[model samples]
Target: MTTETPAPRHETDVTSGPGAVGAAVAAAREAQPWWAGIGFAGRKKALDAWRVLILRRADELVDVIRAETGKTADDARLEVILVADHLRWAAAHAGKVLGRRRVPSGLLMFNQSATVEYRPLGVVGVIGPWNYPAFIPIGPVSAALAAGNTVVLKPSELTPAVGQWLADTLAEAVDGPRVLRVVTGSGETGAALCRAAVDKISFTGSSATGRRVMAACAENLTPVVIEGGGKDAMIVAADADLDAAADAAVWAAMSNAGQTCVGLERVYVVSEVADRFLRLVGDRAAALRTGDRPDADLGPIVLPRQLEIIKAHVRDAVARGARVVLGGTESFTPPYVAPIVLADVPEDSVALTEETFGPVLVVNRVTCVDEAVDQVNASAYGLGASVYTGDRSQGRRIAGRLRAGMVSVNAVIAFAGIPALPFGGVGDSGFGRVHGPDGLREFTRTQAVTSQRFRPLMQPNSFGRAPGTMQTLVRMMRALYGR
Candidate 1:
């Protein structure tokens, strides 16, 4: 969920129009064959060069991310570091993950050998969010390139500078014009990309805008992977490490101003330790700072309009018998929104149900881990969740029952940091995956090829078969199966 707060209302510049969108997609298609022809080894070499370049200029990239997104320097640095790791992983592993592999023919086709390979989807279109501008769009871009497809990316208008930096840096690693191109504009530009003839589209934003992206892609029947909103929860079991869980919740809720798709928004603590958990969480939240300073805990909300949504959620929750245990809506001063912790927030209130893209944490007491699971699963968005328990097995058991796409048993947002892990969500949180082997395949088309190793004793597909062939086959099936 990036800059769904909406871009400035204005007409987009060059490369932001429908004509430019179409031209970029057409150029990507033209360039894809040469990219795929270079083969995995060549692509890997180029991608590794790209990684080296990013590492060398990582400081510059981090500064751009922080400057554009208003996230703390360390937070922005984390994203840059993570993206570098993924670039390395994708380039190094794409061959093994997507290469053709032999498959045993089933009994009916024993005379044949089959194999499957993942082929590039030609041209890939990506629309990224502003929150994690450098990392979010780059996930799809790297996977697509590694999978041998050319890419055309449209970054959030709010952070086009970072997007431009990424595209330009990648271009230095290769000798191509439009292998990767950046388009900057409002929703209209995104709409143009969706309407353009692209093989697939990868979008990360609000569920509402994702729906619109899906609708626009439907005109061309372009397949899409929508990485949308999440009202993720943090479960605190009776046997959990209270201090660790509280600390994790604090960073998860307040870091990046809680604008993360998998950020912690709700907590369901067992009644036995609910009070202690609340105290710890409140202490951590109260101490956290959100200013434009160098050493602040977090930064301002990049999207200006997100303040209203944050304000409305806090106001609604307070109006419905909820108490602000820490900061309130009054702390919002334009882009900077301090962490706001709420207690006894109603189950159906906006604070609990909606995606308040701000530093807000809501706590609810559960009778047991089972009740906590039930409460967490009740959310409409299930992108990700975190479970804290002293018993590792109990954490796994609870994690298995949660409907989120990713679950971190002992840590918060650990799955995202692992480049080999498949990251995405189920239901409204969005469908499809990015990162890992699944991510490599996400932008590819599966092709199954077969070869006849020997002549079949009986050719059922042949018209020259004897009249009694059907009768004999039926008898053989009955004898083999009808015991």
Candidate 2:
């Protein structure tokens, strides 16, 4: 077994205590109304400006992300691209999705005009994860800001610098009260943020940690949006393009050192194509390289603790009669983990059941698409999945049967890039969404307004109503709906 030290702490890292966290929340609460008062158009203008600033400083942001997480430059660049896209989407769509809209008052209440609108929730607390720190936190932060709520972010201790960089850049883009704040520390700081009086909290991490966040928020009866862990699966139909499926499997399973919540951890391929698919996946995974060098395909594992989990899962699978096609426990070299592909891993093995959160893939054979779907749904997590087939309709059909929040047909992790689609999961994967229209509304609450435009023909609300008023109303109801 290879031993690895914990992530190195940086001198520039800021540790926020409870006092500091409380003060940040208080400041956000005080600044929310003014932020909201600017309205959607004004907010959009500011966000657009910020977007430009981010684009101009894209290289710098990428450098900071890569330095903190030890991910490849390409991966870090992808984060910057996604952050800008989500910011633009949230700023542009918030008004249309949350603005007040008129509703029909119905036959009996035609004199009253009714409207419904979503208003900001004042302040939101965001607890970010270490992996994909910038992209993940921006999902909640952009939506919260676009919805007019200031944000207080508590990034993972391992990657505090990335979170602070985001806050500093936003401040440079917009000259006013701090709409986004960063409070850095360990789990205790996150717990404190959850306990604070923020209007809502958006947390992204493991399911185990998410439960604790929920418990903490329960004390204040605060609402929360949890984006937890996922053992996302991919289905390979017999008719699927083996080359395409294999390529996607390799990329999804190994990218970002497989630290993605929506990454492919399990693959269920039909028996007819299992051997060919496995061979292709092994060949491709074997060619990938890992290091901090510019030519490297992937970087070292960001968290030291995760390295052990990856090793345990791989070893348990091998011990349980799984076939190691490419890499195994020997792939461990402290901090850096090479891609490992296992075949026929037992259903009960931790490799198949738990979130390894590393560059490891479990391939299992099934008799048909039905069996593949069953095995995919059998897991406790339901975050994301993909289906590959020659027939688009068949792929769609298989995707519908799988139990997950997002499904990509003939593609991998495509839903995350689209600004209009909501991103989230089910079961142990956690609840609530944070991406598109639903994401914008996640930071706001609905308010219904009704105004009396004119007096009704019958004063049904009055006790001294005229005789036969009830009969007239009954007749009208019968005419409208009792058909």
Among the numbered candidates, top lDDT falls to 2
lDDT per residue (tens digit) for residues 1-483 in model 1: 633556543333433645577777787788889999999999999899889999999999998887677788889988989889999999999999999999989756789999999999999999999889888887889999999999999988877887888888888877765578887777888999999879999999999999999999999999999998999999998988999999999999988889889899999999999999999999988888779787799798877788888999999999999987898967888779988989888899988888988899999898888988999999889899999999999899999999999999989999999999989998888999999999999999999999999988877778998678778778888898879
**Weakest ten-residue segment in model 2 by summed lDDT:** 1-10
lDDT comparing candidate 2 with the true structure:
0.90
TM-score of each: 0.96, 0.98
lDDT of each: 0.88, 0.90
Clashing pairs in 1: none
Scored by TM-score, the top model is: 2
Q: Whole-model lDDT for model 1 versus the true structure?
A: 0.88
Worst 10 residues of 1 by lDDT: 8-17
For candidate 1, the TM-score is 0.96
